[model samples]
Structure formats: C-alpha cells, structure tokens
Target: MTGNGRRGRRILAAAVVAAALAGVLSGCGGPDDVSTATGSTQPAATQPSATAPVAANPEGTNAPLPEGAAVAPSPTGEPAPEQCSNPTASLRPFPDGAPESPALDRIRARGRLVVGLDTGSNLFSFRDPITGSIEGFDADIAREVARDLLGDPNLAEFRILSSADRIPALQDRLVDVVVNTVTVNCERREQVDFSTVYFEAQQRILVAQGSGIHGVADLAGRRVCTVAGSTSLTHLQRAEPDAIVLTVPSWSDCLVVLQQGQVDAVSSDDSLLAGLASQDPYLQIVGDSLSPEPYGIGINKYDPDLVRLVNASLERMRQDGTWSRIYDRWLGILGPSPGPPVPHYQD
Candidate 1:
C-alpha cells in the first residue's frame, strides 16, 4: 500500500508540470498570430470605447455623410466638433461633399485665406516666443498659399487644432488647408481630398537611451508606447503581439510614458520620431522604418472646387522654391523632401 501511494504522488506531479508548460505556449500566440485582447477592457487602440470613430461619409464616397453634417462624437472619447463658418459660395444646407467655388475664388472674395493648422507641432507649426506668431515649414507654405490666393502673405488666418480633429474641421469648411504633417491614406482619401505627396517616410521605433530594444523582435514581454488612433499601435500588434502596448493621445505623451519607464519603446513615423529625437537627446530612434507613410494637405471632398484651387497652388509652391524653402527651414534635417507626386483622386 505504501508503494502504491508513492506512485500516485509521482503521477500527480507530472500532470502539474504539463499544465504549466501549456500556459506559457498559449501566451506567445504562435509565430504570426497577434491577438492580445483578453477579458481586459482595452479594446484595440483606435477603436476606443470613448472615442468611437464615426463611419466615414459614404454618400459620395465609402460611406456617405452629408458634408458639414453634425458629427456626434462617441461619449467615451473626443468632444463634439467645433462650429466653424462655412466657406463662401457654399450652396447647400450641409456639406453634401460638393462646393461651388474654388478656394482661390473664396480667398479673393473674403479678402483672406484662413488656414487651419496646429500651433503646437514642431518644424511644421508652433508659436514663437519672440514674435508671438506661429512658425514652421508648414506655416511658411500656408503663408504662401494665402499670398497666392489673396495677394498678401499676411492675409492668413491660423487656427490651432488637435490631430484627431483636423479632418473633421476640413470637412466642416473650417479651414482652407491643413499643413501639419498630415499623413495620406486610402480611407482618408475616401472622405476628404488630399494634395500631392510632399513627404515620404516609414514608421520607426523610439527607445529610451540604453534600454537596448534593437528591433521589433526584441519587444517580446515588454511594453511598447504608441499614439492612440494611429498606425503605430496596429503595427506593434502585428509585429510583437507578446509585448504590451500603451496607447497615448500623442507622440509627446509616448515620450512621457517612456521617461516614466512605463514602456520600453515608442513607435511612430520617422518624421515625428525625428522631432522627438531632436527634443530629447536622451532618446533615440532605433531600427529601420517598418512601413512607408506619405504626408499631404487634407482638403474637403465636398469642396472639389477648393481641391482644384489648392492643388494648383501646391503645384506653384513646388515649382517656385516655396515648398523647398519651407521644407529646408522645418524638416531639412530629416532629409531632402521627396519630389511632388501628381494628385490622384479615388472616388
């Protein structure tokens, strides 16, 4: 009977070890699978409970939304869209994805071209302590657009905005053009029009000095920092599913997370990473770009007349030395700006 008891105890020990091994394997989720969604309240970065994105206007494009339609933001995240005055010669009660006059026409009639831009962005737009005016390569281009349309560079109205709200502002006829390092993508084009590709880059990694996250493979079991509602989170999910991702509102917030030792790295477009690298000498951008991102000016699709006017103005900026000048002033350190690509409309 004692011999039987010893054998039974050994069998129980073996079973316990096997169960532990299975748990470890399950966490890794195989080689190409990245499903980290557990019972935890975190629902994928962009699809936030608070900041639910409204379906893009699909009436004229993918999902029709009346141009300038009242956008009811999700109760969980962003505030409602701000009320902005409609552009001149606007015919309908709503944006209907169509406007009558060119942006040039409106500028001439209104006596100024109002540009919606971020006053907080680096190299693109930021307030100058000495001049107390917004400045950046993006500001320079906006000035020139105002110059071309209204014959006075000083005739520019600059309205500061957050990253998530720029597209909505354009759709609502709030700004003539946006020059704050806006990335161009397929889904975005369906809702709004885009200028020619002025900047080309890839997503990269930002790490604290000496933490030693060499590449994506090194992120396993570590926490990564990313901007919420941006491509960085999606890429990290696909590449290092085993790692934890902390989504913040902006890349600046990602820096805050990395500094606090909450995350191992911050991944974003190289241009923005370069901005962070310039600001914090203790941080560095690591590894090659994970994906290509092109920057463009976002315009209202309902304002095709405005689109044409802006495109012509951008072409002029490219031809004359305005684009080069602004790029050199703000982002020359990133590398020379890429050649302009002709605008290709996809409806």
Candidate 2:
C-alpha cells in the first residue's frame, strides 16, 4: 500500500509540473505547443468564464460514460485516459430572445452569448479527470448565467481568455459577458459595465510548509509565482519591484511551483488562497488580506439592459435564498452571511 501511494504521489506531482510547464509553453511555443492546448484545462484569465459546453453528452442523449471508466488511473493515482472536462454546457437557443433585456435581445438576435472566461483556473474551472469537465466554482457561476440568458445554459459558448482581456472581451464584442473573477475598479468601469459585486476577495500570501518566510516583507527579493493574466503579476512586481515572479497560467500550477521550490510564494485573492491552502495542508495563507477584490460580472459598455437584468437576477437569487444555498454548498467555511446585500449600484 505504501509503495502504491508513493508511486501515486510521484505521478500526480509530474502531472502537476507538466500542467505548469504547459502554461508557459502555450504562449511561447504557439501551434507547436500542444500541451497547453491539451494539458491545462483551466486557461488563464487571471479573472475569467461562465460554464462551457462539452462535446457529445449533449442533453445526455448518449449517457455519459461511467465516471470510473472515464478516468484512467494515473501513476499519480488520478484516473486518466479521461481528458479534463468543461464545467457545463453551451447556451441553449433562445431564438425568441429575452424581451426584458434589450441588450440580450440584440445579443440573441446575433446568436450565441460570446462568454469570456478563464481557461486555466483550478477548483474554479480546471480540468477534471472523471468527466473531462471544466468544473469549478467559477464555472458554476458562468453556468448559471448561461442558463439565465440563453434559456439553456448549453447555448452559451465560452471563449478562453485572460485577466487583461476581461474588458476587452466585452468592448470588442468577443463576449457578451465576462464571468471571470473580475474585480470592480474605477478604471475598469471606464471601459465596461459591471453587475453588482458577487464575491468579496482580497490578496493573501501562500508559502510552502516550514518555510521561514511569513509575509510580503519576506518576499522582497525572493521569487514568487502569480497567475500570468492577473494584476497579481503587476502587484508583486510593484511591491517588491525587484522580486522574481514566475508567473504561470493558473494558481494550481503556482502551487506546483511552490512545491518544487520553483517560487517562494504565491499571492492572489483570499478565497483562492484559502482554497489552495485547503488543497494541501503544508501550504499556508498568511497575513491579512491586503487588497479588496470585489468581483463583478462584466458586460459590454453598450449593454446596460443586460447588466440590469443580471443584477435583478442576482438580487432574485439573494432574495430567494438561492445565493445562500450555493454559498453553503461550496463556501460554507467562509463564514455566515454578513447580511442582506449592501446595494452596490443601479442603472
């Protein structure tokens, strides 16, 4: 049993490293780099997507393969032969269009909700072995949005994107909404509209087990890892200004780098930091959350109606206890509800 366990860990470790390497190769290798295109399921959006569609398994016509068979056991213990999967389905056709939101009507008339999302974030939208799905908390949120707008969550098509592309995705009409973990900022507002804040996050530091380093001050000259498309990249650069940051496409990969001593620490949102910490007890989240990361849904600047409708839906979810249920389902450990919404904004 011990020997098998050790083998499993080794395989898992190699898989993780490959994932990290793939993130880098994708950008530098281009078409020749098939790993990032194939290895990492969670694409980097530093902020990113709603639930995306899956091939076959559409409407469950052909029953999904047994979950066990779907995943081949990896030397790492993760069953494989099973490719990673997208969290949800494409947006279903709403040919009739939503009369409630004029912007949605326009979008529907054009066909497809071009959703911009992070292709490489873990636990939020990373690859899954059993079902080859891009399953995660972030993807779940996107799934719900696609369900609401497309009348069928399966109708919305997701486009992998990065943090820098959040606003640009909407501005360019490449996407109808950016379900990425986009923080609401003054500058961001200049380019696009935002839904009421959905998640309240902050930057926290993550260090490997037994590492003498405790906080940002220790990071002055040490190497750190942050997701490639995140402001965290810039944040680390500005804070240390001299610290080495080995940026990867996803936080999961960041953890691998830390485990391998490739980087000293990984800094990102508090929830994410907490999530990463939970994945491995050795890694710890330290220091107070330094930056407020109030996440909002992104929409085109030309689409106020869509934003309003989404806000109304969000409010409905809150009022109906749906939001709380989801929270308990996924984030009960975060703490109890703070109270009713603070009422962030209106059209």
Candidate 3:
C-alpha cells in the first residue's frame, strides 16, 4: 500500500480505540463495558461512610502479662515496739509547741521539703491538667507537711516514685519522706519509720462494667492485675492462691490492662481503685475490703524526729479540720469522712 494509505488506516484504528474507551466509561451495555476508562475491572472501593463504625481489634493493645509474674512478698510480722511505734499510734503536739526537731532543722536548712509519691494516682496525687500542678488528697497532705516544716506549702519538690521505690527511697535518703499512699504494715516498719495512720484504705477490686466478675470470689482461675511491690498483690495471692496474678509497674498499668481486656480486673486499695474508675465510666469498683490498709508518711528509720514532726502535723490537720477539707476536695465522691484517724503515741 502507499504511505498515505497506511497513515489513514493508523488514524482510523486510533479513533476506534478512543470510541471503545468512551463506551466503557459511559457505561454502554457491552461485554467489556463494565470496565472503566482507567482500566479498572471493578468499581473503586468506597471509603467507609461517616456514620459507619470502624472495626478494631480489641486485643490490639499492650501485650498481655507474661507467665510467672512477680508476686509481692508476705508482709513481715509486727516489729518490737522499741524499734518502731505501733502503726496506729501517733504523737500529740507539745503543750508549748513542736519541740525543735533535728530533722525539721535539716529540712528548714534545705528550704524545700522533698516528697516521694506516684504522679499517676488520680484522686490522690495526679497532676492537674489545667494548673499543671500535682494536686490531690495526698498532694494536699504533703503540702501540709511542707507548710508545717518550712512555713510554705509551695516549698516542696515532689519526686515521683514507683511502688517498688517507696522504701528504697527512704532507706537511701533519696527523699526526706514518702507521702505516697503507703500502707503501714509490720514488714514495712522494719525498713522505714511511718507516721501515725493519716488515712485508712480498704482493699477492693475494679472491673469493667458487665464483666461478670463481681469480686475476689469470682477472681479464681482468672487473670487479675496489680502493681509490682504492692500489698494488694500479696493479699490477692493469699485470698486466691489459684488466680493468675499479673504485675505491672504502676497501678495505671493495671487499669490499662483491664480496659484492653488483657486482664479480668484490677485489684488495689479502694481509694486508688476509685481514682482509676473516675477516669473511665465503663470501669467500676466491685467487691469489699480484702484487708485494711493504714496509710502513713514513710521516713528514714534513723529520723525518728521527722516521723514525730509528721505525726504532729497530722494531729494539727485533724484538730483544725484540714484533713476533712482535703478529703472533701478530692475524695468526697466516696462519701463523707469517718473523722481523722486518732493518733496513738507509743512514747
């Protein structure tokens, strides 16, 4: 064929191909018409509608607790009265004034009182998002101590401590005192001196709503979450020896596990559990007191004078109704206070 004839045929073929693609894009009924001009053989997948629920993996969260998790040691039995005061006992203020305490003198020399506590405790010592200050019932009590010691509530340096660090911090003198909701027990007294009972907490369990696990009785054979170095783990082990215990670094970690369904429930002091529940409405505290937890300010064993000063401050708080006011500020949701725990002075 001539060159012009060949060129004419090529143009005609190109026109025919363009026509075919138009037919496909226009949805003209034909065998190949189901395809689009872009050459896709199927409809473009539609994005999920705005109101459609997205699927999620409930287990797609932090890993589950490992096997052979650490358990808290059994509490050491009562100590000799001469070594430590009764956990329930506290001293009264001197008739004239707090006697000049060497520990108090050192704290005054430093200008800032150092306190150790968990910053994650919601109602007790968590940070306030708005004011950016760690404020709660425990924080208030610590501030009261600071005020009593240094004449200023703001002159306090809060050092965040893990459950495991409470005693070690005191022993190493890393902190002047620990105002974390430390429970005074026979075993703990051997390592550190504690103030008279400033607050009393009962052990309890927290579970997601409708979890079917109502209390410790239902915890057998199930996974329960608690913090490492916490008395709750020890109590749980004794109460349900067969239950699978999961230990986390913090109480907040236990809440995360329970919310993610990695554990059946989180067990700890009612006050701490209440703080967790306040964060998530779907979570609820169940069960009753597993045991009584008497909270005290932990100080170095060598600093009996500091312990006495803390006890005296607590006494003043109770006398002036400061304890009740602080309680109503953060923990009133739990109900009215039963009145400040009475001081029992061993001396």
* RMSD of each candidate relative to the true structure: 16.4, 15.1, 23.8
Q: What TM-score does each of the candidates earn?
A: 0.66, 0.68, 0.76
Off by over 4 Å in 2: 1-102, 110-112, 333-341
Which structure among the candidates has the greatest lDDT?
A: 3
lDDT for 219 in candidate 3 is 77
Give the winner by TM-score: 2 or 3: 3
lDDT of 3 by residue, 1-347 (tens): 56456445444543433332222112111111111111122221222222222212125553533222232322233332343435556445454545677877888888988888876678998766666577789989989988988889888777767687789888988789899999988788778888888888999999999989887878755667887778987788667554566565567768776777766888899999999998899999898789899998899999877877787788899999999999998998788888888777777
lDDT, residue 59, candidate 2: 23
The sequence of per-residue lDDT tens digits that candidate 2 reaches over residues 1-347 is 36656455545644543343332322321111111212344433222112111112212243321111111112222322332232111122233434556777776776656666654555455556665555566666666676676667556566666555567668977777887777766656667877777777778789977787777767644556776556666555544443445555456667665665656788898777776777787888887655677777788887766876666666666677766666665565557755334445431
Q: Which ten residues in a row have the lowest lDDT in candidate 2?
A: 64-73
In terms of TM-score, the best-performing candidate is 3
Query: How big is the RMSD of model 1?
Result: 16.4
Worst 10 residues of 3 by lDDT: 28-37
Instruction: Report the candidate with higher TM-score, 1 versus 3.
Output: 3
